[model samples]
Target: MRAHLPLRLTRTAAFAAVCVTLAALAHSLGGGTGPDPWAAGVGLAVVFALAMALSGTERSTTTINATLVVTQLGLHELFGGDGSAYVAAHQHGRGLGDALGMLLAHLTATLVTGCWLARGEAALWAMLRRLARRLVLLRPVATAPLPPAAPIAHVRDVPRRLLFRHSVARRGPPLPA
Candidate 1:
């Protein structure tokens, strides 16, 4: 059903869903202070960044470039310590330092993911150019063998016929005065 949504809307909704799901998961575990929730968030960032990089193939990629990154950061900060993460941190009795640490980790992950994406974009661009060049060189142009000639056929010798097949009896024209 979500497929019906516009791409941007779907991705925005998915981002929201991720944030909500992460919060819910933290809550389920009694708070954002799980053993290494930030690590999990890092993994999520990696997946998200990879998806964004792969999505470079789409036309919308250019339009939604900054939006994607901003969304990730906003969601990260929102779900970070003292924000949505607070709920989990409070419940788990995690110290302020830990919460801050977790936030730091998330920030680092986001930045790293973004950097990886930058590198990935350059690499893909170079690879695409290389691929295009190779394709052009390897393309079977004049080097391709010609197809066998087809057998010729004799033309039909049918004579032209009048549209009206039956001849009408000629009515004698009235003598001109």
Candidate 2:
């Protein structure tokens, strides 16, 4: 069964909040002063939610971490500026310290978000399993025993004339011999 709407929404909100927070932290640490684009954050959140919903709930921790890393990088760039500005800044040689700071922030965010999501995934599956078990247990049971069937007559016990008489009925009249 698919996840409920409330659960999906909560998961999406959590993901978006973590991404935005991490992006803001990384930007500030990298000496950025501009505000992040709210539109970008909302767009990314919608995309992320759709992807997660389509991908199903039983994702591995590694997969979650990898996705988080990609999202963090994308958000960092989006927050820093548009794609072109980020590329230009990188080409101009950002300091190693700034690079390390951003890396550390992204890494930390990935680890934390991955763990949180992994735990939630496990719990959801476990709950679903328990619910299924309970449903099975609650199924209606047949309490009454079935009636016994009639006994069959052996072919050898019946007379041959009686069988022939029963086989062909005298409808109207017998055919002319």
Candidate 3:
């Protein structure tokens, strides 16, 4: 058990290190004022997903994916994110808040896509289910089967007179030819 603990910790650290390295590379490459904020996020996400997939262990994949997410979040926060250009262009040299917001949005998309690619839908759904079960607000609804779809009751027949047809013109006197 003690040996397992060290291994787990090492695995976690390795994952975090990989994420930080990738983040650094991304920052160096395109994390600048002129570059699109999504470029680094997408590049890191793709690389992390491939790495996690190649690891060949579900637990390791999940653990690594989570570590990458948290590490990326911290890095984004620490470095003021990669949206300076956008903020400068739109807000005109605004405060760090907008940059942080952009960082959050980018990281969220990156992490979600990375997790999905690494763990697949089943794993994500299971995690969501577990979270739902644990949350007090969702506990009751988590196990509840979806209510049967409402039956489509037939509408009452409409009176024929109520319907209008262009072919049924009034039988008034014929117009002069």
On TM-score, the leading prediction is: 2
Number of backbone collisions per candidate: 2, 0, 0
Per-residue alpha-carbon lDDT of candidate 1 for residues 1-177, written as tens digits (9 for 90 to 100): 112225434443444445435443544454424434664566456545644444424323333445445655554444444654565554334677876765665455445544554465556456767887898999877767789999899899988688767867778888899
Best by lDDT: 2
RMSD of each: 16.2, 14.6, 21.6
What's the lDDT for candidate 1?
Answer: 0.51
Model 1 CA lDDT for position 57: 43
Quote the lDDT for 18 in model 3: 58
In model 1, which regions exceed 4 Å deviation? 1-69, 77-104, 142-177
Candidate with more favorable, higher TM-score: 1 or 2:
2
lDDT of 3: 0.53
- Cα error, residue 81 of model 1, in Å, equals 12
Candidate 2: Cα lDDT at 53: 64
Sorted on lDDT, best first, the list reads 2, 3, 1
Task: State, as a TM-score between 0 and 1, how close model 3 is to the true structure.
Answer: 0.32
Candidate 2, residues 109-149, lDDT tens digits: the string is 67897788778777877898899889989999878987888
User: What is the RMSD of candidate 2?
Assistant: 14.6
Candidate 1: give the clashing pairs. Answer: 31-88, 32-88
